[model samples]
Structures are given as C-alpha cells and as structure tokens.
Target: MSPVEPSTAKGAATRARLLDVAARVFAEKGYGAAKFSELISESGLTKGAFYFYFPSKAALARAVIDDQERRWVAEVQQRVLAQATPTQQLADVMPAMLELLAREPGAWSVVRLVRELGADAGLADDVVKPMDAWIALVAGIIRDGQQAREFRADLDADGLATVLVGAFDGIKGLVDSTSPEDREQRLTRYTGILGDMAFAELGILAHPRDL
Candidate 1:
C-alpha cells in the first residue's frame, strides 16, 4: 500500500475519533436518544464536517456496527483461530476478549443490539443478516477445531460456539448491573470457568501441574 499523506492520516484519525465518540454516546443513550447536534458538539466537529463523515444518525449506527464487527473479528476471532493448538487458541482469545471489553463496557450495548437485531423481522434482512454472517465466521473456527480432532467429535461445534458467545453476552449483562470492581472480579471467574469447560469438553489433558 502507498504511504498516506500527513493530511490524509489526520483526516482518517479525526473520522475514527468521531466514530468512537458516536458509538459511546449511542450506547450510553439509546439510538433514538442520541442527537447529531450533540455528537458534533462532543466531537468538536462542525455539523458539515460530521455530515461529511456520516450522513445521518442511521448511517452512524451502521458504521458503529461495522466498526464493532471489524474489531471483534480482527482482535478476538482471527487471533484465536490462527493458533496451531486449540488450547492455546482458547487461552489467547478468551483473555484478549475480556481485556477488550474491559476497555469499553459499551461493548455490552453493541452486543445486546446485535441480538435484538437478529430477532426483529424489520432488521433481520439488512442489519441482522450481516451480523449473523460475522458470527458464523467465528463459529466456523470452532468447527475447524473439531475437524482437527482438537475438540470432541461428539460435541456440536456450532452449538458450542453459539453457547460460548452467548455466555459472554450474559456476563456483560451481569457486569452492567454491578460495580466495576465486582465486574472485573466476576469476569475473571467466568473466564476461568470457560477455560475449564473447553478443556473438559475437548478431552484435552491440562498441563501436568495445573491438573
């Protein structure tokens, strides 16, 4: 790829900042509650500038979903699935995800919205289908583990993948209802439990001393 000019880089950075700020605001205040006027104020961008990047609130919301999927796939799913060993895969991805969510609790809101989108007929075609495709890609990684004999043949990899992702949603919900300290503590416990379950289900022997 050709090097980006300094001005281009600056423009890209500004756009990213606006997206991040908009996502946080939308998650904190529902989509309906979020205002483009406020977004411009908080982003320190003129209304024309904001419109240049995102045409409307609906467009911004779509950008938020796309941005979220890109990060999840890049940061969590791709890293784990790239590992040679399934055990290492789980270890790498699980902790990485927890760390990612810790950086932004607003992730919980995004995830919940994804689920809602999946269930709504109005959103099912446009919004939910793309989100489901991303999920299937993540789930496919688990199926690959099963095919490799790294995971139990008897267990349904697709079903397990759904459950695992669903569990994260549940944990996020729990955290949203508690204090930050308690949330981290609970998340640690949840991660441990998930790691144990994966090992047990896969019939993988834990490291000698850890067992």
Candidate 2:
C-alpha cells in the first residue's frame, strides 16, 4: 500500500521537522556517511515514526533536494525575474541568490550533496534540471532585452546564459567554504564581476552603483 500523507496539523509539523533535521544531517555527513540512527536521534523520532514519513534515506534526500529547489525558484528566481526590465532582472539574480544562500545554508548543502553524489547515484541530470530551467529563464530575459535593443543582438542568448550558469556554479564552492561574513563579501565581489561582464557583453554602460 502507498504511504499516507500527513493528515493532522501535528502530523504535518512532525513531517516538516523530520525533513529539516534530515537536510542538515545529510548536508553534514553526506548521503553515504549520514547515519539513520543519528537522524532519528536529532529528530527525536522513533525509527518506526521516521519510516512512516520516509521509507528510506534516499527518499528523504530526494525530498530535501526537491524542497530546497522549489523554495528557491518560488521565492528568489520567480520574484526577482518579475522586475520591470530584463537588465534589472539579470542584475538582481545573483545578489538575490547569494542572500538566499546566506539565509538558508541547507540550500547550499543540498547543492554540495548533489555535486558530490549525483553522478555515482545516477541523479546528476535530475539534480541539474532546476539549473537548466534557470538557463532557459535567463535566456528568455536576454531575448527580451535584445528585442528592446537594450542588449546586443549579435550574442547568442542561450550560450551566454549557459556561461553565466557555469560561472555561478564554479564560484559556489568557494562561497560555501568561507565563513558567513566572508561568504557574503566574496559573493558580492564575484557577482559584481559577473554584472560588469554581462553589461559589457550587452554593450550597455553599467551604473557605478551596480558594479
């Protein structure tokens, strides 16, 4: 039989608590090293109760990843991309993401976990699906800017978006390693460079404050 969804408010709270603890555990220990006993201990839930919510470790990990991505897309990407201009949208994406990462270290942990285990576990493509969506979104914004003659039409929007995504991913590890304060500073500097490059590529004069 299929597992039942949490019915009562308390049941839903319990489930959310489990997911929260599980994300931190998986982040700290990685998928292979993370112990179910440790998770149970941290969550203050019995083995049977935990199993009722998540059948296995893999199930919990998948839930964590899905939750993190869904929240990010809804809260950050969708919200920022709703700006008046593609220029503003592009400018806002990195800073908004960095702020999210600062506030939600679990999101960073999920990213690291995916990079570490995704290939061996055959989950790499699945994990990067959200990134692909981001690329598409950025490309669409670039297309809009080009049509408005705000950005250069000669550049390939999709290719530029791919490069932008790759650069962001490459810098993520460095950001993850630093202290919280340092992470913010480094992210600001790196994203500033990104903003400058993007503006230069589009043949637009960036405001001094933007850089």
Candidate 3:
C-alpha cells in the first residue's frame, strides 16, 4: 500500500482528543498511577500512534503541563494582565484563576504531580522551572507597577509575587469544601482582604473594587 495522506485537521483533532483524555486519566489516577495503555485506549489510538505524538509517558505529562499553562496564560492571564495597570491586571486575573481551578479540579492535578515529583532533581527542574517563570512574570508586573508609581516605590516585588501566587494555591481546597455560590462569596471576601493588605504594604490607597 502507498503511504497514507495526512490531514492537518485530523492531526489536530487527534492531539486535542489525546490531551482531553490524558487530563481525565491523570486526574483520576495521578502521575504515578496513570498508564500509557489507558491513554492510548481512551484516545482510540494504537500504542505506536500514541508514541508518534507524545513519545513517552513523561513526555505526555510535560505536554499536559504545557497545555494547561498555555490555556491559562491565554484565557485567564491575557484577559486580565493585558489591561493598562499592572495592579488592575493582577486583580482581575487573580480571582479568575481561583474560579477556574475551582470549576476544573482536574486541571490542578498537574500541580499536584509536579509537587510530588519535586523530590527528583530531574523532574523538579522540568516542573519547577515553569512555575518559577510564572512567578517571575508576576514579579515583573509588580516591578513595572512600582516604576510607574501605580504601586508603592518601597514594595517588594519578589516577596509580593510569592505571597500572591501562594495565596491562590490554597484556594482549591477551600473551593472543594464549599458550594459554588458560597465559594464565590467567600472568595470575594478573601480576595478583597488580600487586595487590601497587598496595597497597604505598598502604601497605595486602593478601593476594594479595584481588587
């Protein structure tokens, strides 16, 4: 038989399908328990076909991280951070990130996997590097705000970035414990207080709504 023709759309569809299934599998079984066979079966693809796209289970895990990060940066980060003021950008994006993680718990499984893998030097570098980059991005925005006088000149950008991102990490647990409506209300209150504190540290006067 002659070589099969490849359609770009079909290839894209396959990749999307695989990623979707992989998210579910990773969430259900976790990184250590997740299996390549299950992913292949869920994708309705042969082992060789799956390998052609992802190469290995470790590679697939990396793809999952990258896929989530890209969607997060595009949909959540861009929507908020693209605004005029860095403070406004962070304020808008912070709550949305909380809501997104709360709504899609499966999406946070990669975070759990990364944390679990942190003990391994090789895996830590792979996983932790992206996290550091995200933190660095946030720090950069804070620094910009300070330079513009949108934030206090004395503000500690790196420290503030760490606290801000660290605050959001605990949101998943809180969200899991409450009803969606209650979660929203509680998160609003929580974020409001956090915003107040953050602005206060920089000696900046901010309305609660600004956060």
Per-candidate RMSD vs. true structure? 5.3, 3.0, 5.1
lDDT value for model 3 = 0.70
Cα lDDT tens digits, model 1, 1-211, are 1112225878888877877887788667656667779878999988887777877766666667677767776777766767776556765666777777778745654654554454667554655444454456546766666778776778776677667766766666566546656776698787678767766766777831143
**Which portions of model 3 miss their true places by more than 4 Å?**
1-9, 82-84, 103-105, 170-196, 205-211
Backbone clash tally (model 1): 0
Clashing pairs in 2: none
Q: Which lDDT tens digits does candidate 2 get at residues 22-62?
A: 87777666777887778878988788988898877666776
Window of ten residues with lowest summed lDDT in model 3? 1-10
Q: Model 3 residue 189 lDDT? A: 74
User: Which candidate model has the greater TM-score, 1 or 3?
Assistant: 3
**For residues 60-130, could you state the per-residue lDDT of candidate 3 as single tens digits?**
77777667766775677667677778778766766666667667756756655665565567667776555
- Per-model TM-score on C-alpha atoms: 0.72, 0.82, 0.76
Collision count for each candidate, in order: 0, 0, 0
Residue 13 Cα positional deviation in candidate 1, in Å, after optimal superposition: 3.9
